[model samples]
Target: MILGEFWRGLKSGIVELLSALIAAGLLFALGDSAILATITLSSFSSELKSESVLEVFLIDEITQDGIDSAKTYISSLSGVSNMTVKDPEAAMDEMSAILGSDMTDVLGFNPLPFSLEVRFEPGSCDADYLNRISSGIALRDEVMEVQYASEWLDNLEKLTRTTYIITGILLALVIISSLFIFVSLHRHISTRRRDIVRNLRLLGIPPQSLIVISMMRAIFVGIIAGAAGVGITILLWKLCCNYVVTIPFLTTGFTVLAIAAPVLLALISLLISAGRSQSNLFASGS
Candidate 1:
């Protein structure tokens, strides 16, 4: 009978329930955005220990001798991340794919330079320090056009900032919406007070039964929200993978907690509401 009732109510109330659950799912997505920004900011704020990963692309042309000499020069730099040499031909091939043309034809020659990739400790990503290091290297007679830029960090910072903003907005919406769920449920129960009391008093239904039923309903909502939330998040992750590092939708712990916590909270809130409503009904009948 309870299962039948649940299904009946699900069909009738599907629209409202789904809207609320989807709102919950949106919160899950924003959770990831917040996670990424926090991680990135922490990475930037952390102190330098030994070395950091730095990638430098050379767009200028150079001879094999120059490549070897550049490698030698970079090897001598203090606190090098790792000096890997990318040849101009390799760079040109990559450029062609990105540009969709033979850049060499337009330029009349290979303009790609053999740039040294220098990695330093975490703190070394600073613009002023990087400029000093690169410029200081360029002053060497053999080095040509060593480049470092504050602009290099701009795009990364902007991306994290954007994520932070989106997360904040979505998080607020989710919180407001989650709280709305309790309000809606309470209103529905109050409106159905006659039906609820008639059935309970007629059947001598224990208070525990109502509480358990509400808990079950909450679990159902949570499962749907978790599944829907995870599915949407994965779809987005796939789309972003083409251009950026799209992290996995939810780590195991977060997935479990996201599903569990909201369900528990909803069940508890409804249980309390049920008790208060039932108390009023019993009092009025007396």
Candidate 2:
């Protein structure tokens, strides 16, 4: 009997049902896209940070003993993953290869200073820590200069943080909009079926059963619409990966939540609307 009534309600409001489905699907898709962007940006930023290296230049006149001392000091510092010392001649050679000619020959001197190419561990590449290390290294007698892509790293971190904040706001708005949509859909359907609901109540049908049937209809719509949204998001993600840069899609846990969230929202709306309907579904006839 419950299933019969549920099907009847669905068929009677085909137009409204389709509208709700489309709206809900779009909301879900928007939410999914926000999540994907947050994940991809975070991953990209981490990769860049891990690969970043700090360059420390030595004074031209520093002896080999001073070079060994500097290397020992830097190696003992926390978060120093690895270090490679480039002698003046080696640095000149590298610069010569890049410029297609040796500046040493043109100037009658190899003026490039010795330097250390330093790479840090995963979590210690932030601006503040690197800046502190650079300051300390610069004060050493053998050190000429300390430099790294500090500005670039700072910008990348800011960009990742901004992406996260925007994504969070977008998701919160999506959830709020979804709730409003579900509430409106419930009211619209209930208003249209008022007469049938009143007659059912008069015939000794329990209000709880009526509410349950309505909730069942909501669940049905939620599942179908949620699946549609997931499909759309997947299609978009695939297109992005093919034409644009590649990024991994939603994980299993997030995919499940994307489908379940709409259903949960629908059920919540029905419960709220049912609470306000009193014992009888009609406003005047109750």
Q: Show where candidate 2 strays beyond 4 Å.
A: 61-69, 72-79, 122-124, 127-129, 139-142, 203-208, 238-247, 278-285
Worst 10 residues of 1 by lDDT: 45-54
Off by over 4 Å in 1: 1-12, 32-169, 240-246, 268-279
Colliding residue pairs in candidate 1: 52-120, 59-112, 59-113, 60-111, 60-112, 60-113, 61-111, 61-112, 61-113, 81-119
lDDT of 1 by residue, 106-192 (tens): 889987766565666555455445655677667655566664434645454465567667777866676566656754764464455
lDDT of each: 0.61, 0.83
The residue-by-residue lDDT of candidate 2 on 43-154, one tens digit each, is 7787777788889899988898999999999998888999999988899889999999999889999888889998888766677677788899999998989998889989
- Give the top-scoring candidate (lDDT): 2
Instruction: Tell me the lDDT of model 2 at 245.
Output: 51
User: Candidate 2 has what TM-score?
Assistant: 0.82
Worst 10 residues of 2 by lDDT: 277-286
TM, every model: 0.52, 0.82
